[model samples]
Target: MEHLKTFLLKRFRIKDLGDLKYFLGIEFSRSKKGIFMSQRKYALDILQDSGLLGACLDNFPMEQNLKLTPTDGALLHDPTKYRRLVGRLIYLTVTRPDIAYSVRTLSEFMHQPRKPHWDTALRILKYVKGTPGQGLLFPASNNLALKAFCDSDWGGCRATRRSVTGYCVFLGNALISWKSKKQTNVSRSSAEAEYRAMANTCLELTWLRYILQDLKVLQTVPVPLFCDNQAALYIAANPVFHERTKHIEIDCHIVREKLQAGMISPSYVPTRFQLADVFTKALGKDQFVTLRDKLGLHDIHSPT
Candidate 1:
């Protein structure tokens, strides 16, 4: 580290910051157990800017089974505020995967936000207020094996009827990457949706493996990819193709190819233990809390 610093110092004038305490809007704190990250100040600033600092707090970001259509309610008089707030919330999701689904849903309405959509967006703020210091924790561990969970909500979007794909990848116990997104094409069945999600997860895993290889982190064993759908697992393992899966032939090929190459091993995980469920849809408080803990999110400000 000193050799590189000396080389850079000789050519360009630079000052050592010593260690990364904060960058952009993220706050970092370290201990023997692990490094903790949060956006507490950023979150509080957002609440103050939106006049939600004193609003009633919410235990969870969104209601379970809540559906928001494009034409649900009257359009907002000034959508600029809605757009800006949702945009900031989108950035906040970088360290707060707990709110990913809510923010993703709100982002869809940015083009034509309705009153109800604005209200739902504010509800997210209220939830943020409850734990502004909540963030990801990278625990100190020697294990670096990659594990992943992927899920799909078949036809989750009420307006477009598009399935939502959600997946989270962990290096050891630390969450490295996650996403909640709507599929571009409509799926004919739940298995197809799950298969598409597996394909997307496979792509992410493949990229991460390359990154690890560059960092000299050798992966001797194939990474485990957990999915709740048995049919999807069977599809990945099965070599024969059928008419039912013809539409998603490309997606099947992507996952099956990786499986055949021993890059990723697809397995079944029960819905209750599926941590990716929180990203796919709005969950109840109990289930949300359960999965949120499993995601390695910690509130540093909370009493021990």
Candidate 2:
């Protein structure tokens, strides 16, 4: 590391910056255990900007089973505030996957945010207030095996009736990538929605594998891809296609191609053990907390 710095210093006008304590808005702390990353300062700035620094705290980011449509309430008179807040919240999801689903939902109303939408956005801020220092931890471990959990909420969107895809990828015990996104086409069944999600996860895992290979981390075994839907697993493992899967032929091809190439191994996991559930829907406090802990989120500033 020092040699590279010396070579760069000879040509480029760059200072050593010492260590990676802060970069962009992310703050990092290192110890023997591993590294902990958070955007506490940025989170507080958001709360203060929204005039919610002193607001009451919320236990969770969004209400369970709370569905917000584009026309849920009266449109905002001035949408600049709503748009700006949601934009910032989107960036905050970098180290805070706990709010990914809420931010994704709130982002849909950027064009014409309603009063309920604005209120829901502020509620996410309240949840942030409760644990500003909460963030992801990369434990000091040598395990490089990759595993992922993918899930989908069938016809979750009340406005468009589109399914939502949620997935999380882990490099060993540490989470490396995650997403909560709505599907473009409406799925005909829960199995199709889940299969689409599996395809998405396969793409991510494939990309991560290339990245790991570039970093000289070769994966010896096929990465495990967990899903709660039995039908989806069968579809991926089965080479023969059925009439019901014709609509999603492209998605089926992608997952099956990867599975055949030994890039991923699809497996079944129960709904309760599906860590990606928190991203697919607004879960209750108990489930949310349990999954959050499983994701390795911790508040460094909170009392131990």
Clashing residue pairs for model 2:
none
lDDT tens digits by residue: candidate 2, 1-304? 8899899999999887776999999999999989999999999999998889889999999999999997779989999988999999999999999999999999998998999999899899999999999998899974989999999999999989999999999998899999999999999999999999999999999999999999999998999999999999999988998899999999999998999999999999999999999999999889999999999899889998
Badly placed stretches (over 4 Å) of model 1 are none
**Candidate lDDT (C-alpha), each:** 0.94, 0.94
The digit string of per-residue lDDT tens for model 1 on 1-304 reads 9999999999999989997999999999999988988999999999999998889999999999889999979999999999999999999998999999999999998899999999899999999999999999999764999999999999998877889999999999999999999999989899999999999999999999999999999888999999999999989999999988899999989998999899998889999999899989999999999999999999989889
Clashes of 1: 0
Q: List the candidates' TM-scores in order.
A: 0.99, 0.99
In candidate 1, which residue pairs clash? none
What's the TM for model 2? 0.99
Q: In model 2, which regions exceed 4 Å deviation? A: none
